[model samples]
Target: MRALTVAEPGRLELQQRPDLLATGELALIAPRVVGVCGTDLDIIDGTIDPAFVSYPLVLGHEFAGTLLSPTAELAAGTRVVVEGIVPCGVCAECLRGDTNRCAVYDEFGFIRDGAAADLLQAPPHLIHALSENVSWESAALVEPAAVVWRALTRARPQAGARVLVVGDGTVALLAGILVRQFKPAQVVMLGARSDQAELATRFGIDLFTTDADAAGSGYDLVVEAAGAAAATAAALAAPTRGGVVLLLGYPGAEKVGLPVDDLVNGDITIIGSFAYTRAAWHEVVELLNSGALDLTGLVTHRFALSSFEDAVATLRHSSGARGKILLDL
Candidate 1:
């Protein structure tokens, strides 16, 4: 098998590795479509949390693939997607049904080997079936999609509620669909650029400027998918007096400071959401197949394992691709 490894920050190297297989509880995953995200960029640039990672770490988490070997009702050759979060099942958080907050949370690609190769290995618990309706490219969004899906769990958005989604990334784009699932009266997305706003329009989401009052007109909820401090602040300010600000983003390179006085005065409920939950993952798969979230235009670029530099550079550019950039192994 071949895999892409990050020797150090700003360095990518392709190397050969032994094939992986399902043994005991783990499952073998063959890389199909992998999405390039801001986190990957953070890892590549050495801005992510370094306490949990060492050099020569694999750099992929958002991906979909096939089963190499499995006996837990997952047939070989069946299409599948990777959940990417590997939590210690024995931990109190995992035992209590909050796997995202498990004490031994070690994210794949960040703290463990990930799906940046022709063949990858993961626990069966982190794998999910991909419906025939969801394409491999769109399936790469399973990880980030799961991020928003779980954030919505914190939100519990009611029907006819006014919602605002901050940021213009693919995760925020998917949040629009998730908000729509709650039957919100209106779902608006704030983008930093006009070109990117066009993509949001295609999804039938009202696009507004980052500083616009898209969510300021007394929104019931504000979903923060952008990890920037400014975006988080905006999410806090977007919601109504009694609304909740559900945050799904991780600020890898910066710290987020909240206004306690304003928070108390506004009577705002701030919810911090992390990785996916088991139920959220299952429901999001169905959402992809429901024809409600159109991901056709989301996948923009593809690069082979050998073209890793080109792939990373494309993601680093300001005028980046519409949604996810893929690596085919």
Candidate 2:
């Protein structure tokens, strides 16, 4: 089998490795697609905490594949989306149904061998079957899409409520679409790029200026899909008086102080939605299968395995892209 190994910080190389065989409760998959998002870039840029990373590991988590071998209710030949995170079931948080908070969380690509290879073996429970019509490339996005679903769920916008989504990436775009289901009177995306503004138009959301303006426009709800400390602050600005703002993106170590005066006087709510739950994942699948969740504009670039370096480079250079980047095996 072939794998992309992260030798250390700032190093990713394609290498030959023993084809993964089904082990313990794991199954083997004929990997077909992997999506490159900012999280992937975080690893490549060495910004993520090293405590979450193990060197010389296979480095892809946003992927989909056909099951080559299986040992449980999940069968061979099934096309599946990789869940990528295999939490220790025994954790206290897991017991509380907060597996995302698992202390010994085993996240693919970061802490373990992931699906950047031709054949990847992962826990059988992690392989989510996709309907035949869904392309592998789209299936690879289930992880990120599930996250959008969760953030919307956290916000719980009501029909006819004006909404603001602050961010300019695929996650923000997906969040804009998902919020539309609630029949928000208007959905506006606030960010720095006109490029992302074009993508928001494709997703049927109107583009707005800064986060505070989005909020000052009197939106009933605001979704803070941007993950940076600066962006998070901007997201807070997007919420109106007595409105709600959700933080959904990967913010790294960035921190922001809330407007205590607004919290008290305006009654604004700042909600943070983290990694997705299993139930949210299932809901995302249903939304995707129903044809309402189209990712047609999500792919900005597709690269061969040999061009992994180029793939990562575009992520840093192509800030203008509105959609997710894909790695074709």
Candidate 3:
């Protein structure tokens, strides 16, 4: 098997490795599409938090693949998307259905080798079968979609609510698309990159602007997905009094000054969401299977697995409209 391995910080290689065998404990999968995000860039650049990453790691977590062998319920060659978080089932958090908050923070593409390789293995319980009609591009995004879905579910935006999404990246775009299920009256996106305006509009966002002032305020729900201090500040100020602000981005140890007085006076509800729970992952898969969500068009870039270097370059410096970048196996 050929794997995109990061031997250490600032070091990455597509190395050939021994083939993996299917077992009753772990299901073997041939990854067909692997999505790369800022987190992967953080790993390659040695910018991610040390506690969550391990060296010589495989560079994939967002992916979908085909089963290599038959399981008790699922047959061989079934298309599937597996949950990346490997929660300790015995932990208090897991026992209470908070798998994402388990005491042990093990996850694929971090502590464990991920699906960036030609072959990957995951616990059968974590694997969810995909509908035959689900495109590989859309299936590869289930992980991030699940993350946003969990946050939105927790916030529970009401019907006809006004929403503002703070970011133009893939996560922000996903939030814009998923929030529509709540039947919001309007969805506005504040993005730093003007090139993303067309993509945002394609995702059904009512308005997209580079200027925060042009975005106006008084949103019933504000989603911070840019992972920047400035974006967070914008999100905090955009919401109406008593509105909900969902913080979904990771700013990597950066701290933002909060408006404590305004928060107290405005009676705003701030929700900080982590990764997706077991239930949330399942719900996202259900949405994909039932045809309620189709994000294939969000994939604007694709590179062969062997062309990972070019993929990383595009990820870092693409000047044009960019959405999800995927590695095709």
Candidate 4:
């Protein structure tokens, strides 16, 4: 099998690996598409928390694949998207339906080999079938979409509320797109890059601004996806009194000052959403299956697996409107 791997921090190579086979509870899969995100870059650059990642790891957590073996009702060659977080079902958190916070910490593309390869070995219970209507590229995004879905569901913005999404990255763009289902009166995006206006507009964002101060405040709901300390602060201030602010970005190990007094006095509800739970993943899959979410035009870039270097470079130095970047197998 050909796999793209970060052999160590700051090192990446596409090399041949031993054939992976399904054994016991595992199932073999041929990854059809893989989506690379900022987390992947952090993995390659060794900037992610040391406790979460292991060396010589394959670099894909967002992907779609074809099942190589039939399991239960699913047929062989079925299109599928496997859950990245492998939860220990018996754990206390898992039992409570908070699988994202499972006591056992194991996830694909992190502690285990990911799907940035010709073939993947996944647990059968974690795999979910995709309807034929869903595009392979769209299916590849299920993981991240599920992440955004979880965050948005947590905040539960009221119907006709004003929503503000901070950041121009794929995550932020997705947040703006998904919040629409909640029937927000307006969805405004605060991005750092002026070039992202077109992409944000395409996602149906009502307004896009690069300036946080001029972007206004008192939003009914605010989402922070820029993964920066300043953006986090902007998200805090953007929400109205008694409104909700959701933190979906990862700003690394650095700590940022928070307005603790304002949070208490303003009766603000702040939530830090992590990975998706089993229920959140199911909701996203249902939305995609029913065609309620049109993921079209969201994938603005594509690269061959062999051109992983170019893909990584583009991610680091992208200038204009950028959406999901996929590595096609």
Clashes of each: 0, 3, 0, 0
Compose the digit string of candidate 4's lDDT tens values, residues 25-128: 89999999999999899999998888889898998999999999898868999999999999999999999999999998899999999999999999888899
Pitting candidate 3 against candidate 4, the one with the higher TM-score is 3
lDDT of each: 0.79, 0.78, 0.94, 0.92
For residues 1-329, what per-residue lDDT tens digits would candidate 1 score against the true structure?
78899889988888888877667867787888888898888788887778766668888888888888864778888899866777788988889878888787687898888788888778776677777888886788777877888889778989999888888888888898667878888888876666667678777686556556544657898888877888887777777788898887776557777878878988999898877876777777777877665466677788988898898888888473367788977
Q: lDDT of candidate 1 vs native?
A: 0.79
For model 1, the stretches where C-alpha displacement exceeds 4 angstroms are: 21-25, 210-215, 251-261, 289-294, 318-321
Per-candidate TM-score against the hidden true structure: 0.91, 0.93, 0.98, 0.97
lDDT of 3 by residue, 1-329 (tens): 99999999999999999999888699899999999999999999999889999998998999999999888889999999999999989999999999999999989999999999999989999999999889998999999999999999999999999999999999999999999989999999999999999999988999999998899999999999999998999999988998999999887677888998988898999999999999999999999999999998999999999999999999999998999999999
2 or 3, greater by TM-score? 3
- Backbone clashes in candidate 3 total 0
lDDT of the structure predicted as candidate 3: 0.94
Candidate 3 lDDT for residue 260: 87
Ranking by TM-score: 3, 4, 2, 1
Comparing 1 with 4 on lDDT, the higher-scoring candidate is 4
Worst 10 residues of 4 by lDDT: 250-259
Clashing pairs in 1: none
